[model samples]
Target: MRFLVQRVSDSSVEINGEVVGQIGKGFMVLIGVCDSDTKEIADKMVRKMLGLRIFEDEQGKTNLSLDTVGGQLLLISQFTLYANCKKGNRPSFIEAGEPGMAEEMYEYIIARCKEQVEVVERGQFGADMKVSLTNDGPFTIILDSEQL
Candidate 1:
């Protein structure tokens, strides 16, 4: 499992020209599930996304977690995060999990995240969606389950 987390002031996702999900003042999560990913890894990543202290404190220090600031969550499924491009011009997605399994893990992560935040909005899984966001502090981090 892997995730690209970006702190955003506001974000929205549209599928086929219809708004699907949106959020304000939280992290925009682009999640990718690998063939080896399991529920354990998804759970661990959820905890980290909720607990990671990327928000600023009263003193202007980046020391507060999203929970402290009362933020929302915007989660999106993005298998391209695992793209393998070393071999050729066209990126290969052989490392990405099958659609069904990936969808299960994606839903699991979203359900888990709701426990820590006021709201958790998500894009349609496997859809060609349009995502927009005003990145806050331009703060971004990448988390991989294998690294843990």
Candidate 2:
């Protein structure tokens, strides 16, 4: 599993020109799942992501967690995060989880997120999505399960 976390002022996902999910003042996370990913790994990743204190506080210090700031969430499934480009110009998705299992994991992550976040929005799994966001601070973090 891998989480590409981007702190955003606002974010939205569209499919066929219809907006599906959106959030404000929160993290727009692109979640990637691999064959070895488990619920435990997902749990740990979510914990690390939620615990991140990248948001600035009153003192202009980056000292606030998502909970402290009452932030929402916009989660999207992105298998491309696991794309392997070591061999050629084209990327290979062989490291990404199979569709069925990946979708299940994706849904599980969203449900787990909803348990902590008051507003957890998500894009449709396997859909052709157009995502838009205003990256706050242009701040981003990549959380890989292997590193965690």
Candidate 3:
């Protein structure tokens, strides 16, 4: 499992020209599931996302968790996160989980996030979607479960 976490002032996802999900003052999480990913990986990622202290506190220190800041979450399924380009110009997604498992993990993450945040919005799992966000502090973090 992997995640691209960006602190955002606002974020939204649209599919087929219709707004699907949106959030404000939160983190936009681009999630990728690998073939080995299981419910354990999904659970771990959700816990880390909710607990990561990247938001600013009263002293202007980046010490507040999402819950402390009352922030939302925008989760987007992005298998491209697992792209492997070592062999050629084109990237290979062979490391990513198949559609069925990927979709299951994606939905599981969303359900878990909804329980901990003020709001948890999600992009269409396998749809052509457009995502927009205003990055807060220009802070971006890339996380991989295997690294942890």
Candidate 4:
């Protein structure tokens, strides 16, 4: 499992011109699942994401967690995060998880996030999603299960 997390002032996801998910003053997260991923890894990601102290506090320090700032969450599934481009011009998704397991883990992540996040919005899994966000501080973090 892997997560690409970006702090955002606002974010939205559109599929076929219809808005599917949106958030404000929160993290815009893209989730990717690998073939070997399990819910345990997903759980670890959820804990790290919400607990990350990246939001600003009154002292203008990046010391507040999402919960402390009452931030929302905009989560999206992105199999392309696992793209392998070492061999050729075209990227290979061979490291991406199978659709069924990936979607399941994706859904599981969403459910867990909903519990900790004040507002949790999610893009449709497997959809051709168009995501837009105003990155806060242009901050981003990438988390991989292998690192845990």
Candidate 5:
């Protein structure tokens, strides 16, 4: 599993021209899954993500976690995070988890996040979503299961 986390002042997702999910002062996380992923890995990733101290404190130090700042969440599934373009112009998604398993993992992640976050929003698992965000500090982080 991989999570591309972007700290945002606000974010929103749209599907079929209808807003599906939106949030403020939180992380816009694009979650990716692979065949080897499990709930345990997802759990670890969630912990690490929520524990990140990228938010600035009163001293202008990046030392505040999501909980401390009372941040929301906008989680979106993105299989293309596993795109492999080493061969040619076309990218291969063979490393991405199968749709059925990936969707299950996505839902599990969302549920876990909702338990801790006051406001948690998510895009449809298999939908073509249009995501918009104002990246706070232009801060971004990538969390990978293998790295954790």
Candidate 6:
């Protein structure tokens, strides 16, 4: 599992110009899963996303967790995150997990996140979605289960 987390002041996802998911003052997390990803890995990623201290504190330090500031989450499934471009121009998605199983694990992450996160919003599992966000601090974090 991979989590591309962006701190956003506000964010929204649209399909056909119609808003589907959105959030205010929180993170816009794009998730990617591989065939080897298990529920345990998903659970670990959820723990990190919720507990990792990326938000700013009163002392102007990046030391606050999402829950500390009452932030929300806009989770989106992005298989393309695993696209491999080493071969040619066209990216290969051979590393991305199968749709059926990946969607189940993605939903599992969402459910786990909602357990501690007060406001959890999400994008459609497999959709051509357009996402927009005002990045807070332009701060981004890429978390991979293999590294953590």
Which candidate comes out best when scored by lDDT?
5
Per-residue CA lDDT of model 2 for 1-148, tens digit only, reads: 9999999999999999999999999999999999999999999999999999999999999999999999999999999999999997999999999999999999999999999999999999999999999999999999999998
Instruction: For each candidate, give its TM-score against the true structure.
Output: 0.97, 0.99, 0.97, 0.98, 0.99, 0.97
Q: What is the per-residue lDDT of model 1 for residues 85-105, given as tens digits with 9 covering 90 to 100?
A: 999699999999999999999
Please give, for residues 1-148, the per-residue lDDT of candidate 3 as tens digits.
9999999999999998999999999999999998899898888878887889999888999999888888999999999999999997999999999999899999988888877776888999989999999999999999899987
* C-alpha-based local distance difference test score of model 6: 0.94
Candidate 6 lDDT, 41-121, residue by residue in tens: 998898888887988888999999999999999999999989999988999999999999999998999899888888899
Clashing pairs in 3: none
Ranking by lDDT: 5, 2, 6, 4, 3, 1
- The local distance difference test score of model 1 is 0.91
Judge candidate 3 at residue 31 and give its lDDT. Answer: 96
In candidate 5, stretches whose alpha carbon ends up further than 4 angstroms from where it belongs are none
lDDT by candidate, in order shown: 0.91, 0.97, 0.92, 0.94, 0.98, 0.94
Q: Give the Cα error of residue 82 in candidate 1, in Å.
A: 0.6
Report the number of backbone clashes for model 4: 0
lDDT (Cα, tens digit) per residue for candidate 4, span 1-148:
8899999999999999999899999999999999899888889889998999999889999999999989999999999999999997999999999999999999999999987777999999999999999999999999888986
The residue ranges of model 6 lying beyond 4 angstroms of the native Cα positions read none
- How well does candidate 4 match the true structure, expressed as C-alpha RMSD? 0.7
Query: Which parts of model 2 have CA positions greater than 4 angstroms off?
Result: none
Q: Tell me how far the alpha carbon of residue 84 in candidate 6 is from the true structure, in angstroms, after superposition.
A: 0.7
What's the CA RMSD of model 5 in angstroms?
0.5
**Tens-digit lDDT string for candidate 5 (36-144):** 9999999999999999999999999999999999999999999999999999899999999999999999999999999999999999998999999999999999999
